[model samples]
Target: MQVTTATEAALLTSREIITGEELGSVPLATPGAVAAAARRAAAAAPAWAARPAAERAAILSRAAELLLERDQEAMDLLVREGGSITGKAFYEVHAGAAELRHAAALATGPDSPHGPGSEPGRETEVSRVPLGVVGVIVPWNFPLLLGMRSVAPALALGNTVLLKPDPHTPLSGGRLFAEVLADAGLPEGVLEVVHGDADAGAALVQAPDVAMVSFTGSTEVGREIGATAGRLLKRVVLELGGQNAFVVLPDADIEQAASAGSWGSFLHQGQICMAARRHLVHQDVVEAYTETLARRAAALRIGDPYRTDAQIGPVIEHGALTRIAAAVEEAVAQGARLVTGGRMQGPFFPPTVLADVTPKMAVFHKEVFGPVAAITAFADDDEAIALANTSDYGLTAAVYTSDADRGRALAPRLRCGVVHVGDQTVNHDPALPFGGIGASGNASGFGGRAALDAFTRWHTLTTSSPARAYPF
Candidate 1:
């Protein structure tokens, strides 16, 4: 790709999320650069694909080690650039390494060829092969983990990749991966990192050489990418938004359920797609749960993530804070009682809890991707299940109850991708397939064997022992 003149290039400025202090900047890649990246990746795909699977696996394994070796650096970047608390940032680094290791395992375990049918004098077998070049677009939240989820799998499966990180977090999301892979001795052109706005993402998706696009972001943007990729006949995997639920049963321990609810709704200031936005508590214990949750919310310390005692940090910027505050205000105006907190102090939106929130309120029905927990009272198990399934999103859901058998039976009827019987909704594991149904995603789960399936294509070969006449 031709480098643009200094004056012609755009710059993305990096800043500390809590302090608004400018850290540094990087020049944004234009759409043309994105196209060039795809072309280069296509050129590099053949040699990478021809290497033995063991070699590929080794490189990814080394990459995983190198990633953790530099965990301090990555954790700091995540906290400063991504507005992540210390604990959440630490989780992202380790989770990203786990994803790389899982991808390495997938590299050595290509699906075995299977027979299709028993036909006279004919043998048929099906094998999985890599798609040439994959376009990966990741969002700002959990940048390192989400980026690795796509980039690592695609590279390990023998496909070259062009990654586009969100404009707000180019350094941690894009450049960090490049640095780690290079340190691990990965080939230069096999993984290209591009930074820009939506135009760059579009260019990567529309590039002729890119066979597939994997995107993780909002539902609104996922729809647009899906539409465009469909028109181009390109493969796509989208993991989008959610209004997930945390259900508290009458028989559950109120204190334990309250603790889970607090973490589910306030971790990372509740920016996660799987964060519990809706709290559905049985009427019998709703009052106690609300009181406990409200007290917990009021107690959480909000400040710079660098502080050892800080539990909550700032939202991305002023705009996000404004949006969160507006949603809380609107909900309160609609008769939802502000139980404890509904205020924004500078860039920090404190952990908030709202009670008597009904489906009529926007905060109850929509995705309030902030530290606001909207609680609604349900009368019975049937009502709790109904409220949990009310949203268009079918991501992860949590059910708290003393009876394990009841939780297991209700799990299948939740209509979501994952369920935690006694835990919170904000959970992730590299070995588990994760995604959602309905508006949450296109049901394109990532991780585990799903990652393998997402990056490969199946081909069938037929052979005959003796010469056979063709029916023409």
Candidate 2:
């Protein structure tokens, strides 16, 4: 793993999220070390850029193969260290591999060298060029998938990358992915890993050699990083927090709505950034929907992450577990009804649904990244739209209705970047531009081509055709 010795002053400590056991420590990277890595990446970037797109895509394709071969071990590590269940772990493995292959396909396509032709004796040539070194900062949740979204694309598009994974999840989530790419014939310094806290992340954001910063984390952290990236006029891709709202329409299938909402709220213990923390249902069907959702949520099995049949797993750590517990307790104290699954055992928080959640409560107004979903009944379409748009975040919103046209009509009123019809709010596809607005970050507006478009700048070339006077 090329792990450096841990100094007493800067030790990188990690605890097993499932078992609460201690993991072997590694040395945290200092600002100088981060800058050094960035410098090395900047030096190798031009040579990489010179390589043909097909050749660069070959490496990314090979990386996908290598990741599939090591899938089981990777899933095990996610379960042990990252508190991911078996199904979620398997999803992560295949999803990460698929993203790499998708990026590889984008790399193999034509580079758009021909641009557009002008009739006035001139032609404009447009091309996509790398923006030097790309600094990727990923969070503990879905580290492999999020990291690959930026890394695979940058590598395929011929830009060097310096990845700094969350310090709380160094080995399984961050450093292991780096090692896998290394074994797949990636050149040294082309993809390097640094482990540390916020200091290391700030170093990457502020480094002169790093042309752009691609970050995925909380809204608070995104704001701080966005401020710096803005002040310096450096490029950045921020996928921040989401207090997403899932609307249940009157004509929606109650069972399907309940099932999708339960899964969206309880998956990964609801630590996901796009997880549906708010449930807005039409008053006409509120009683039936709440009952069905509570029943479905109660049926989920929560326990050891390593269990084959376990559907719900523990939260990432003790602090997160405690925070979730307190949030639930406070909601109950504020006159909210605990529908089901309010028990806490160690780090495990079973699927919980709260009814009668008013806007004044913390759970209703704030972003609770836990397995707690609040169900509120809206009198009409106008009231429901108002409720969903009231949140400060505009990351993702969903509307569930039997009629596709009804879903489409209602989804537009919710203020968010991505809106799904007859689907859960907790969804992601690499081809779709995944981001947010307001307190949640906004999209760079280049869809499908996520990190590649975000990390590269466009240039237009013109050539005058003055000698064409012989044309009759």
Candidate 3:
């Protein structure tokens, strides 16, 4: 990996999520070093941007190939460092590679078009220009794919990037990218990994040389970064938290709805931003849905992610596990029923289902990033929509119904960035623009053609054959 290995004042130790065995430690970059990295990226941006678009595209394409070539290693890193199950880890490898390939296409995509000027003998054209230096701060949930969402596109668009990954998953989130890119022949200093916590992240956002910052994490942290970037007049993209709803209409198939809801609530142990935190089901069928969901929750096998039989794995850390347990306890105290799986075995939290959950319960309104599905009953469509839209978060939502047209109609009414009909909330595509609104984010999305807009600014140029004489 090409990460900064310089020994410094503080150190971040990486441990296996399941075993808690100390794997390694890396020196943490101070705020001053982070600023210096930004300056270095700024200095390197020009030469990188000056390269032909095809050459830039070629590098990204090769980076994708290299990542796929090392898929097993990358997947293992994700499973060990990021607590992703083997299947999810494999998904990360391919999804991350897809993001790189998508960025490669962006590199050689058509330029902005020219237009006729208002006056004769005049020509006008608009072009997209890089932001110079970009700061990308990603969280640990799906580190590789999330990091690639910002890093690959920023690099492909001719800007140098300074990546700051969450300390907990540094290897999968940051260093792995550096290794793959370097192997793919990326120029030195075009991309650098600054490993630290809030200190390093804040430094990168406030660094004068960084023209833009793309952050994915908690809403609280995203708000702080937004304020800092605003004061500094830097461009910012924030993809924050979500308390997304998995709505089951009365007409929905109970079996299908329960299965989809179970996967949505418990996949990756429900640590995803788009994980279905709330199950808003119609009162007519709430009982059957809850029972089936609880059965699936109880059936999931929780163990080491490396184990082929383990469907659920350990959470990121003890603190997160504690918070998750506390949330469930508080919900039960507030009159929520624990249908099944409320306990933890070591670091593994088995899939949990909370029935009779009311809005008054903390788990009903707040996001508990664990394998807990809080179920609430709604009397009708209006009530279901109201309950679904109750949260301040608006990242993603899912609607389940036999009638496709009815699901489509209700999709728009739900307040979220992406709504899936007859599917789970945790879904991603590098070719689709993804983001959220309200406390979730500021709606500066990522992926596809939207990536071009996120990483570049428009520049207009005008030309005339001859200058007109002034009145004076």
Candidate 4:
């Protein structure tokens, strides 16, 4: 377990910098290379799960047309190894090439909208069956689009994967997904990449030939990988972490809720888990939305995430800028009110904006992430739904308000799972379903048909028309 390979450095300002590339302590896979890649994906998962789901949706629509013809080398390795910023690295390579063309249009067709005829002469079918190998454990914030939205719908539903990434961005998740699955031909052990970190993701989630693991990142290591994949009964897909809450509503539009809550709390600089780390506001336009969100978070443009007028970058390493400057110096030593930009400077922490934040501050109960923000000041509408349902995090929440009945009556009392009104819960759309709820972790990451029903697993063949022979 002594593999060592490091680099680190970051900066991006005081004499510009950027280094990253680390691997370090790597020894995990030699249980005969995880049993020969899980016995060659259990002997090619029953012939790629009996092929023809429109030929596995035409190889995930030619790997989303070779990932939009290699979108500027996948936004320059997601802005040089995921520190991302050139407009959030071209919105994570155009939302991972539109989540691989919406999982190749849900794998070319439809089989179960819970209908395939049953109970007449009986021939019930509710298809979707891959779940053979898939171990994916990505996360260094949008590292190659959430590891190609969890390895392109688990290789367009025929499953078989090992992925792992995030040892602080394993060279853009092992060289941009082995050069786009070798330019879309993809067959060599379906999809493999096993770099290491976090004990090689706990040896591929305690590898018992990995049946299913998905995972994204931190909800305290996704509750320890859902308690070690629920004691190895496997099948998990968590996409944890989010302190998300934006609110606003004193008939919001105070310059579009202060430019969408200062670009959803400093875009990637907040090291997003759906940024906008709690704002609340609305004591009748809390002093004009905190003076137009502290003049749009001090007119952003921090530095060097490959420019393009860098809307604040650089908080990837340096221990997330020293835990976001120690959660804004323990929320200004527990009195909160730094009102605008708390200074960090090296890993650029300026976009900060804490105003009287109190949920017994720890940047308002943890998950500050980076570009530190924390407002809080509600009056009406049930005290802005009791300060956005005081968090234990329910992921995405936002509600600027021009009164669409008070943003649909305070968006379901804001307990969160993905709410947005006038907009800025970091609006996403990898065909929808994103996740979060309580402690911000409970499996979900864009619903391209709910990620093929979380990488498949269901079987029920009941043919009863064989002249009803009853025998218990």
Candidate 5:
């Protein structure tokens, strides 16, 4: 692939998530510059990876402190990036700080010992060691937190990182995070930030010196990255697209499920990968649930994301609105009823609810990263499970049922990465594992211990005394 070198630097511009006005631009390392930085990181990787675990942890700890000290500045940048509403800036910053702190703890934590089944006098240990250089690509949605999830753990384990944040929105998140690491006494080139479009991301993914790649974005781009990494025989962890389902069983409280479902479908203008888009309701209560969901969705406040009272803001960009509109229109054209919303006022697409959706409609099968809820009424538990699992994408699914035994029995039957019995599908925790299955990407989870594992390789070591008799 040809790299762009037309300008000395690349400019990344984003639109305000509330006003639809341009938020100006931030300068980023161009593809050529990114390659140079990757080379620098490659040269520095071995030395960085050889540092003592506790010492490595200290840098992360300092980074976390610096993040807190500069909280306002960090949150300001995120708002300017416009990927998240102003109301959400606090959560992103807090989550990011927690990730850095957790990584520091992981670095200084005890090493893993061999399991109890080992033979006597044969000392064994399983240790996770850093990959030389990690190339990370973060999506516009939740850039600071998701991007740092890979960066913090990888660095704690002593791997150098070259991050390529989404061109639409980069700085004040991934770029800013790297800068803070520098302020915290991290050596230069250990964490580099390169910002651009797909070309820049591809350059990082294909870099021969990079030992592994961690990507969080759509499944289409993930497939390309995964394939490239496979060819190179390099380690890769991907968090891709999600078409999560919010299933309300017969025993569910319609009012409660309706409120949660509305929020789950419209949060962040429904840009989240795990945003609950599919609503599978039992036929017995579908009418009542739809009315409640529509009412709650209609009550949402929409305006500038920076406003404290704003519950729903503009979609990330005008193009996002167009895509969402097209999907909803197509579904409607195919006979799906637009129960609540299907109109866009500039970049603002109001909370939408589509009822009587069928498996054949685009709104049901395709992942719509917008505030459009596609509700399909099902006949029984078997049909609900079938409808929920029908989508090619299976990242998360939630079942709302009062009966514990039934919910437990049905949760696992859904072919998804995670299922919540009482909660909505749009839940995320920094300490738990997160990722998708099937087209949503590989089984590699994106947070907690699994995140650390994704960025590192495990080495099993065994030693025997002279008296030991065992095959090598």
Candidate 6:
């Protein structure tokens, strides 16, 4: 097995790598190599699409079993390659395996809502068919889960896939997945893993034979891919960036709200797009809630990602750490006060809590992809709603209120795609639709059954008796 390194490129974290080996230099894939992989996928797509749904499902199920069997190895790779805590990696593997199982179940069941069904008199049938080839561009955060989320469904739907995992964590997850699928008896060229950077991603998206492109990354990159796919007239599913808000109401339990805020903001070192970035608290409970949150934030255990007791880990790389530090510094300079945990040690930035953060501060308005939480006090219900909806993002939001009426009422008013009451927004069930609106890229909805739909194209088959034939 030959491992080749492309030109050295700089990452947001200032970390560099060559052939999956980090050496304080950024790594990238050459345009020719990515294009070749795309071509290979395109060439093999039709044959893959011809495979029966049952066969596809069986193979995917085998892959799932393999993943479960190698759970520890997967978790370790996730932690080392993606910079996530051991617990988080465990959850990733579990969720990813579950996704594969669900997708397999869906494949063997029916042809979706559009599939053929029995009727008493009428001969009507609809079918769910593969859309040839799919290109999945995954992110560094939750690398294993997100990559599998897109790939498993696409493969289950009988579509060949060219998956380009995030360059930062490509070899660990991507190589493992490819090996598993191959060992599970999946047809060669049906599932391919390409390692590279943005040029590689662009090649996958622009490949003329690709039927759809599914991407999970920042909003800026999503826009670029969406525009390219639009020009090519190919379907696209994008899960982009988010600046989710966590609203703490006057009647909320201060302790519960504080705990949710701490976990929601610092989980995965706050690299999650759905992680609560803004903390909008009611004036009545603001002081107490802030105090509790600050105390909890400071107490978080940050160490190597492989440590079981480590609650927080490094921010992917040093460049990510730098960007997060700069965001906090700018926010403080603009008037926000850092309550605790703003300093950086290696790639780890201690869980940070910022108080008195007005909407004007960058930390309040932008997606600070780090373990930083910005707190602002709102005087009343209307003010809280306004503050929460002020951001350009509407991916996810949370409202903490004990009153049933208040919680229900506020839920509908939130501009986000998903909302949780009395809890910080972190719920991601494989059965429910998950995607966002506004600046969060336009995929409409995805996840669970919706994600399965994204991997297919519908075809209607209507028949009529000879006597009822239409006149030409």
Q: Judging by lDDT against the true structure, name the best candidate.
A: 3
Give candidate 6 regions above 4 Å deviation: 1-29, 114-124, 464-472
lDDT of 6 at 117: 53
- In TM-score terms, candidate 1 sits at 0.97
lDDT of 5 at 112: 52
The per-candidate count of clashes, in order, stands at 0, 1, 0, 1, 0, 5
Q: How accurate is candidate 1 locally (lDDT)?
A: 0.89
Among residues 3 or more apart in sequence or in different chains, the pairs in candidate 2 whose N, CA or C atoms overlap within 3 Å are 436-441
Candidate 3 C-alpha lDDT tens digits along 358-428? 88778877889889999999998888899999989999999999998999999999998999998989999
| lDDT of candidate 4 over 260-320, digit per residue (tens) | 8888988888887888898888777787788788988887777777655677777767777
* Candidate 2: stretches off by over 4 Å: 1-13, 21-25, 112-123, 444-447, 464-472
Output the worst ten-in-a-row residue range by lDDT, candidate 6.
10-19
Q: Decide which is better by lDDT, 5 or 6.
A: 5
| lDDT (10s digit) by residue, model 2, range 291-377 | 999998889987887865788887877778788888889999999999897768877888999998878888887887889889999
lDDT of 1 by residue, 115-221 (tens): 57678777888888899999999999899999999999899999999999987787789889999998898898999988888888889889999999999999999
Order the numbered candidates by lDDT, best leading. Answer: 3, 1, 2, 5, 6, 4
Number of colliding residue pairs in model 1: 0
> What lDDT, from 0 to 1, does candidate 3 have?
0.90
Residue ranges of candidate 5 with Cα displaced over 4 Å = 1-8, 13-25, 115-126, 460-472
135-221, model 5: which lDDT tens digit per residue? 988888788888888899889888999988787666665668767899888988899888778888888988888888998899999
Which sections of candidate 3 miss by over 4 Å? 1-10, 112-117
- All candidates' lDDT scores? 0.89, 0.84, 0.90, 0.75, 0.83, 0.81
TM-score of each: 0.97, 0.93, 0.96, 0.37, 0.92, 0.90
Better of 1 and 4 by TM-score: 1
